[model samples]
Target chain A: MKKYTNTGSKDTRSGFGAGMTELGQKNENVVALCADLIGSLKFDEFKKNHPERFFQVGIAEANMIGIAAGLTIGGKIPFTGTFANFSTGRVYDQIRQSVAYSDKNVKICASHAGLTLGEDGATHQILEDIGLMKMLPGMTVINTCDYNQTKAATLALADHHGPAYLRFGRPVVPNFTPADEPFVIGKAIMLNEGTDVTIIATGHLVWEALLAAEALEAKGISAEVINIHTIKPLDDTAILKSVAKTGCVVTAEEHNFLGGLGESVARVLALNNPKPQEFVAVNDSFGESGTPEQLMEKYKLNNQAIVEAVERVIKRK
Target chain B: MSNTQQLQDFSTQVRRDILRMVHAVNSGHPGGSLGCTEFFTALYQQLLERKPGFNMDGIGEDLFFLSNGHISPVFYSVLARSGYFPVAELATFRKLNSRLQGHPTTHDGLPGVRMASGSLGQGMSVAIGAAQAKKLNGDKHLIYSLHGDGELQEGQNWEAIMYASAKKIDNLIATIDLNGQQIDGSTDDVLNLGNLKTKFEAFDWDVLEIKEGNNIDAIIKGMTEAKSRTGKGKPVCVLLHTVMGNGVDFMMHTHAWHGKAPNNEQLAVGLAQNAETLGDY
Candidate 1:
């Protein structure tokens, strides 16, 4: 197995802020809008650098979405920042009518996703945002794994035209990806190569899949790990090739199994190559207030859960 | 550059177009469309500072968004007659494979429409956004929008209303079609929008009213005054008090025609009341 090391620990939101700050200097038409969560979304530096391009839209997410859609009419690229729940559900119609149906180039950047939002509880922690965003036609959905990947995705989105949703988390995690890797929208990253089972993961679970692969290797079981950053316009080619070699698969994400990466992988396999697959995700349930570490452990979303899922799928194969 | 008689002739033709299009489809909102005929005619024909042809990014020109998009008949007629698209395409209103959807949208590459609106209370925010962009681009042209009085019940309008004033978006003119009727009943019975002039004033907007909203000259004068109030540090609001079905006598003083198309006999009456001056599509 190739060795991967964490260069540092950093929050994904900070990566977005760093990318925005860079974009403020690089792209003149890039504008940022926040709905009373500028500090939470870590957009202070961009606002400070480009006060003329920044808009503070108070607590109205709907108005922020409409404004973002409108800003696109005159060749301005608008980025809207808010929590994952408010970003997807609170302003769904506004996004649907003004952005998605109208074909506006607006980037909806959401932080504090899933149970990893910690003590803010179920209200702030949204596990269904990926499903909601992916359902909209022409909406590109991206969920980054770490700080490095998140920053790279943010920069890539500036050049990407059309409505898109970029989901990230609040808690700090391992920044394992290289600093200078060019982020591709729909390409999956190959983390490891093995013959036993294929492990497909997204968001924070990508790091966990790497750890699980190591644990499985120690048990004399070989595993292949893949990181899926973009859920919509999924990288089916990579998944099919890896699954064809391994003969079975386990999909992991910090979202409900019914609508997350697991279901998408299931459809791809069921149609072309049916394989025994297991899911390591939330079982259609809401999250509660707890530390992100405790929540990950209790929800069975850590490395141990992935290892178990891999073992179960390998047995079926 | 059109004189009063020319604008009146244009409005009569637009009203005729609205009645015929709705009658042919047997479904569409003609009540508010009839009421706002003069306003649409005045704005498109004589008021807006526009350039020939169409593009999505309408830089260096005025932009208009229809918030209460159910009244698409008047919007479509005015847009077509004003040369945004061919007037003959008005026959395709609300049919299968038509660019003119039931609600106004830019989805089908329709010219003259900047955003999708049928869902009410969203146009103000969009207009405010376009106004802000114009400011950012150093473009001096203004952004204009129209809404229904019933649309104010939607909470998002208040959010945009507060935002426009707080941001001092002075280059926008949002006019409300105060027809005093919705799907259910009169605005008084449905939900009393008490003292709209004061309500807008409290929101820190410069409010004006065109009491004779059905009159072409009155609409032009009032909207021109509203335009003069622009760039003075606050957004301007024009309250247009129009009868629900203004031109046709039988359809007036009630909400019956809000979304219902006139039958053959009623259509004949409506067509006769507003004689075609520029011919039909």
Candidate 2:
């Protein structure tokens, strides 16, 4: 792999923290509710600056979601922070009936998602969160990559009415996307342009996708990498256009392959524009306690597996 | 709407509206709705400091939440007769593409409902949260919530109770509709909610029990006392002892009518028990 740049890396949760701090300064109605994950969710600064707006609900995510829904009645924009498992699975029914179906403007900001959550193990790592949230009718699912984009996404979801699930993670990957990139829901961003095959990824895998593209470039093959941050709305126009041009697709995420972004892309392509596709995601297995790097290798979610998937899909094409 | 006769007439019309709304829908809950009719009517029409029409962001005046939202017939009837929406919309209950569903929701832009509640055990937390918001806004007016006695078993209710008391949520007051019946049978037989008043006292709530929850004067007195008890560094709980079916004779004092709609003939008898003080919808 061509080592383009390795100067800096940042934890995505810091992006959430930074964005929330900005929102607190800019908007008076922006409030934060956390379930004993303020430090982990990178919300210490907001708590200090805006103690009135920040609610430390203390380890009860179900109540936190309920409170967030209530706060919306007074025309307040509430951002709820917790781990992915606690944010969605443990409080699925609360989020389903209270927030999503009730149509409250609540931002369900979840950090430390998937196997990338590392040493905390499978119980804390929610591989099924995306599926659970996406199954709801009025939920906007977004998995932001790196520091800048995650921060931008957090700020953007603040202004968006209705329930939204903004997911980020623990790993500190490359911060490559433009720092000032305006976050847009239901849209995909193309990082690199090519014609051989398209590499679509989200969350921490976007950096891996860019690396895979550069590697394929050295091998006399041009790879187009598209970062798909929003999974529910499944940017059908971008996916169809990119696949039609490249003739093959490789989707990557730090999530289960069953109902993650790959499956969403597959469903769209399978119907309108059928193409060869490869998925770089965790198979049907729970995670064990390990470093984030070891878990990535064990789960087959590294750049090497993605590069191989791209080669396989290209051959099929 | 000016005279005492009109206010009494309004309450009677609300009771009639509740009967017809549930019967027309054929899939609505009328037990809790009928049980707490006078209490709700007094709260909206006489007790609460509210404007004629409801606003989403209700300011200055007090707010109420139906944690036990299965009683939507009563809630909607009170809200409509209180002039929140057109009374004709009550007939659209449970129909496809209708604003009124089996469970109460705010999805149809229903003016009165703040949040959806079909899944039980969440309304208390929401009500407590609204109270918290009232405190945040520095709105001295209190918040009101009505929960089912059988719903006390939900761990979330305990959490809300514990949280409100621990934090001294003084600006909030909640009521438990102590009807003592679940869908299956008696509340004693279903889950045995042993002693709710003692339970609230142990949880550090200022508990007040109403002997006749269906009586308008008692409801008015109990609700006013509950409101006055707030702003004193403790949340108030009024354990209302209400009959499962209060006004209608044949439907009263039985768990069978907890979820069943009255048959056409039964509906006539039930309607006859309560006079149509305000014209029927």
Candidate 3:
């Protein structure tokens, strides 16, 4: 539907690992805890360079979350890394009490998020993570689009003093954003200006939103694409302004539509500016073992679906 | 480090604080707190080399985590007497919007509490985590954890025990207050912990037994032995045998006072047994 330049791709997890290494060297108080996914989480650098700051907590996500909370009490900023599923679902209570409700400054670094975890199947691919995290009070939820943005977001959460869930994914995605873009938390990045409809996307869907915008541009429809990396603090002004001018909306994410970015955006728009919105996300269903492309096609989480959602919303408007 | 007399006096003072704090609110777990007073006092006064002012990170100081958070009275008493907070704050315990709640939580920004541990069976995991943090920070300071025998029913403690042994978390030396009484009744009646030493050994932990846990001198010796056994690749799990309601004649030997506060009449009787060495909060 859209023609875009191909860029070199990199796994977002590497962004986390590289960012953590840089942050560890810069701040002595920055500590890391990993629950048996050292290689997967790319925590090898932090562990090697700052051995004292890296905790290889073997298969203890619950304990790791708790210990991370404890480290925060001592004025230490702790980053906990694990798969998205175990990080959120496995230790929800621990995060809810020790981190979120208690308001500890811990970075819940989650890798292998969404269906892109690929072949690890339904169990490892956690689509409900954003929903679970967003429900908790005082929790700042972030879903970075690509490698560069995820890397920047990881470093940014360390400076912010509160409980934060930094969600990233496995598959190597397009590394199009500037290598050193400043990641402003809770602020949406406007990729393109348009007047017909607003395409609000997050995480892997940011690239899709860009693709849909190019297709819509060719079809005489000006689609505004917004990258909503930070889902919790929804950047009300930017979102409302874009929605007010566009008069319709379409949300895209690699997660379930129930409590993911779509619902968050809908809530913000409902309060500020009521507009017709269509969600382009995994329809209330769990993921299965498949290739990233297969999973995307099966879940209807591709650029074509996003463009269609935008067209439907535009027609309704 | 405190000598024998200092340990005794600190133990008495902690017991006094526990009684008064619980009596003030007419709500708290006094039985186990009373039972573990000497053990906790001995550990704080003689065992731990702490800084004068309390810091949350405890970078240089040894860390202690209470898994059984219901026994907040004993923990609050020891913390206050040990100069973790102003002794006067003991009266504010469980009061309206006080740092000292019914459970140990960092929510109030309390200096000593590192995590919220009202949910049982999570403290050991948290302790092991803190111990792991110490290792990660290259800080060789030891960590201490106390748990009630009956509270072991929460399977997470055993999971942590298994993990510590497997990971060789040798820097952590934990003590289990084997008072053998829960709110329901004896540990045997509630859920048989089924041979704790055997369990710890099976879990590959360096296990030790303290027959006279409530005795301050014995507590000092046992903890010394526990500390000596560390630095190897196995985490130390010391089984401390203590009475449910120790120190006070009437409260001892039963689970009735496990969570019940001492009424005014019983409060006087309990206070008579423990003199306020550092003055009442």
- Tens-place lDDT per residue, model 2, A1-317, is 33335437999999999999999999988999998888899999999999988888876778888888887777788899999999999999889888888898899999999998899899998898888899999899999988998999998988887899999999888887678679999999988888999999999898888888888888988898889999988899998998899999999998898889999999999899899999999897788899999999888898898899998999998
Candidate 3 per-residue lDDT, tens place, A166-261, comes to 999999889877876799999899888889999999999999889889888889999888999999977888899998899999999999999999
Instruction: Output the lDDT of residue B189, model 2.
Output: 93
**DockQ values, each candidate:** 0.84, 0.66, 0.39
Q: What value does DockQ give for candidate 2? A: 0.66
Residues A42-116 of candidate 1 have per-residue lDDT tens digits of 999999999999999999999999999989989999999999999998999999999999999999999999999
Give all candidates' CA lDDT scores.
Answer: 0.94, 0.86, 0.86
Top lDDT: which candidate number?
1
Instruction: Assign candidate 2 its CAPRI class.
Output: medium
Number of clashes in model 1? Answer: 0
Model 3 bad stretches (over 4 Å): A1-5, A21-31, A44-54, A70-77, A101-104, B1-10, B23-26, B135-140, B262-278
**Model 1: per-residue Cα lDDT over B60-124, one tens digit each:** 99999899999999999999999999999999999999998989998899999999999988988
Clashes of 3: 2
Candidate order (TM-score): 1, 2, 3
Across B185-237, the per-residue lDDT of candidate 2 in tens digits comes to 98899899988889888999999988889877787788888888888889899
Per-model chain A TM: 0.99, 0.97, 0.97
Candidate 3 chain B superposition, TM-score: 0.97
